[model samples]
Target: MRVLMVGWEFPPYVSGGLGTHTYELTRKMPHDVNITFFMPDRGEVSVPWMDIKRIKTSIGFGPYMTFGGSVLKESIIKSVEDYAKEVGKTAKQTDFDIVHCHDWLTVMGGICAKRENGKPLVFTVHSTEYDRSIGNPCPWVMDIERYGINEADGIIAVSKRIKEQIIEKYGADPGKIRVVYNAIDSSSFDCGLKFKPTEDLILSLGRLTLHKGIDHLLRAAKIVIEHHPSAKFVIAGKGDKFKDLVEMSIDLGIEKNVFFLGYVPQEDITKLYARADVFLMPSVFEPFGITALEAMAAGTPTIISKTSGVCEVTNNVFKIDFWDTEKMASRILEILNYKELFEEMSNNCRSEAKRITWDDIAMQTKDFYESVLR
Candidate 1:
């Protein structure tokens, strides 16, 4: 089986979970399955397992872009279109048994490829516009998503929550959608580097956005700090909400307790996960929270929103409503104050995360591809 994968980010060029997903999934594919991966030409990525084809576009936009200006917004919109057009042209010449794409960004290319080759088109919905925009989804993006949902031969949703969203939002056929929970490679968290903190560190790492529920986490931090005064809250990753979240911490009087580390490098990620006393993922509409898994795999006790797709798979992490700051703070304090509970959770999560591996994910994906082809 040959797959032509249309995606945005992969491995070293990643801005978020989508890149990690692509890299892990592709590398673990069955030996019989040939994958020719197509992505925007950021640089060259060579691997013995698969053939990578870089598609060049003049657009300079990236994933999870912050909307600071109309010019930037317009540029990003044009970039996606331009990328799709370029990908379509490339796909027409490439030979593959199936067309697979991630998110709306690559749907057009997938559609074009399917049209040209009459092959099975599989669209994977990592997230929707509603998740990104915090309920107010962009019509343009939504339109594209709807079209992809309707056109695809099969759909893969990262979580049951995402599958439900597709059905409810776009009236997609439930039969065509399969719920495939994302997996983590436990070995990836081992870099031999450690970040020893002077104080108890509470970490929240992701793109700073409205849907991330960072503001709610900040509100919870104020309460947590009142109890654990020396505890430090770290918000890592860059987004449009960076300045807003900083102001929020100040307004809540927890400025002294919080540290905003913008755009953490890939190498330091494992260290941050290893050293953090507890990892917080307070997303308002998280389709699937991969960071929560990464933290849990590192044996860091994780506190996640109930709405997260990851919550559906794991019982090792603490679950709470995104708006419940009081409960969020209480959970943070529970892990901080209690040694036995923390150790038990830490030990159990490490074991639990290892059970779900990318090899298993690749096999399931291969099965899905065969099912779609049938």
Candidate 2:
């Protein structure tokens, strides 16, 4: 089967989980199926059986007479029309069997491609803007999300939480949505010999955003410090909330205990996870917390918000409400102070991580595609 995937960001240009998902999905898909990845940015990466096509989104005159080139800056109507034309051209040239789009950024391109090719369109909802913004609704985003969900022949939600959000917020048919949990590349995060004595490291990985509830984690850190003053809190990743979170740590008088390690590479992240005794994600709202899986894979006990989707998969980790700082801190201290409990949860976490892999995810996604085509 030939599939044309429309996505906004591909690795190196990635800003969030969506880019990682697209890159890994295309890379690991079976060689029998031909996949073409279309993105806005040009990058130098290639995959077997997958063609990475960078759609030029620039507009200018001659080489020297250029003013400004913005293919995506066109009016929504013109952008949609242009996308429709391009899709018709590509479909005539390639004769693909399916048009798959990831998220709302590529919805216009996907809709056009689906209409032009007369093939089944599959839309993957990594997240909804409504979920990201909590209750604050943006009509434009909601409209686009609804259009993509309504147009697709099939829709993929990363978690049941997100699936319900789609149905509730956009009034999508629940039956049409498939819940495919986000997977991890375990090979990239090798679980070597377990460390006998890990440092007092508590790690949190992801964008430093308001919804991530980093403030909540900092508050919990303050409580945890009273028990284990040597404990250190490390937050990895960069976002608009970095400075705000740093300030919050200072305001809480835990600035000395908290460390903001911004945008560590994947290789370095594994090392950080190996050195950590526990991983905490106290997100106000998380659809599926992939970092918890990574930490678990590294043989570390994880503490997640009860509201997160990862909580649905494993019984090994500690879970608490995002608002319950006292309970969260108590759980962290329990993991730190009690070696027997920590060892048990760590063992369980390792076992749980083995059950999830990108290969299995690829096969499941392939099956979904085949079912949609049929």
Candidate 3:
């Protein structure tokens, strides 16, 4: 099958997890399927089966203003319309069998291409605006998301939680939505048994945002520090909330124990994961926790919140509620203090990581695409 995939970002130009998902999924998909990945920009790396197409849409002042406030408005609508026209032209030229849109960014393009080409449209919802914003909802963002969910022939949700959110919140048809968990490339993380750092390091990697619940991790860090004074927490990633999180860390009196290693590159992250004793993800509204899976692949025992989608996939690691910093810290201490439990969870994490290979993810995705086409 020939597929034209539309997404907002790719690696090196990534703003979120969607880019990583697109990159890995296309790389592992069967060579039999011709996949053209259309994004705003291309990355430095190359994929053999994946054809990269760049589409430029100029966002005017109004769109920029709305984007600044995290609101999608008239400018966003105009930009999407322009993006759709460009994608429609590309679809006519390439003759792809199916059009797959990654998120709301590509919704307009997907709808235009599907209509113009008379091909099936497949949409993947990484997360909804309501989920991300919680109560302070932006009407325009929600409207765009709803339009995409309603227009697509088939939809893919990263987790059961997200699927349920779509059904309950957006009123999407349950029959059309498929739950496909995100995956990691284990081979890249196979740097075996690097020496553990002399200083005890607890690692957290993700965008520095309110939804990520880094403050919750900081609270947990304070609790862990009481047990293991040597414990140092390293947060890697940059976001709008970086300064706020830094201030929160100071106010909690765990500033000395925490280091903000902003935006570690992909290569360095793997090495950091190797040296760490535990990976902490305390996201309040994580649709799917890819970093936790990556940590598991690197043989690091992971502690994730029950709210995350990764909790739905694996049973080997520790799970705690996002608000329960005490329990989170206790779990971290348990993994750290007890060698037997640590080794057991570590071994199980490594074993479980193998099951979530990109190949398996690709096959399942292929099934979904074919089902939609039929």
The best candidate by TM-score is 1
Error of 3 at 5 (Å): 1.0
lDDT of 1 at 95: 88
RMSD of each: 2.0, 5.1, 2.7
Model 1 TM? 0.96
Instruction: Report the C-alpha lDDT of model 2 over 1-374, residue by residue, as the tens digit.
Output: 99988866767765577778888887778877788877653557565557777666532211011112344234443544454456456655666889998876677678878877688899998777786776775566568789999999899998889899999989998878998888887656656646535578899998887788998999999999988999999999887789999998989999999999998987798998888888999988888888889888888889999888888777888889999999999998988889988788887787778788877778878989998998
1 or 3, greater by TM-score: 1
Sorted on TM-score, highest at the top, how do the candidates line up?
A: 1, 3, 2
| Alpha-carbon shift of residue 63 in model 3 (angstroms) | 14
Runs in model 2 deviating more than 4 A are 58-92
Q: Rank order by lDDT, top first? A: 1, 3, 2
Per-residue lDDT value at 256 in model 1: 92
lDDT of 1 at 63: 62
After aligning candidate 3 to the native by TM-score, how far in Å is the CA of 267 from where it should be?
1.1
For each candidate in the order shown, give its overall lDDT on alpha carbons: 0.87, 0.80, 0.83
Clashing pairs in 1: none
Score candidate 2 by TM-score against the native: 0.90
Q: Candidate 3: minimum summed lDDT over ten consecutive residues — where?
A: 61-70
User: Which residue runs does candidate 1 get wrong by more than 4 Å?
Assistant: 66-73, 190-198
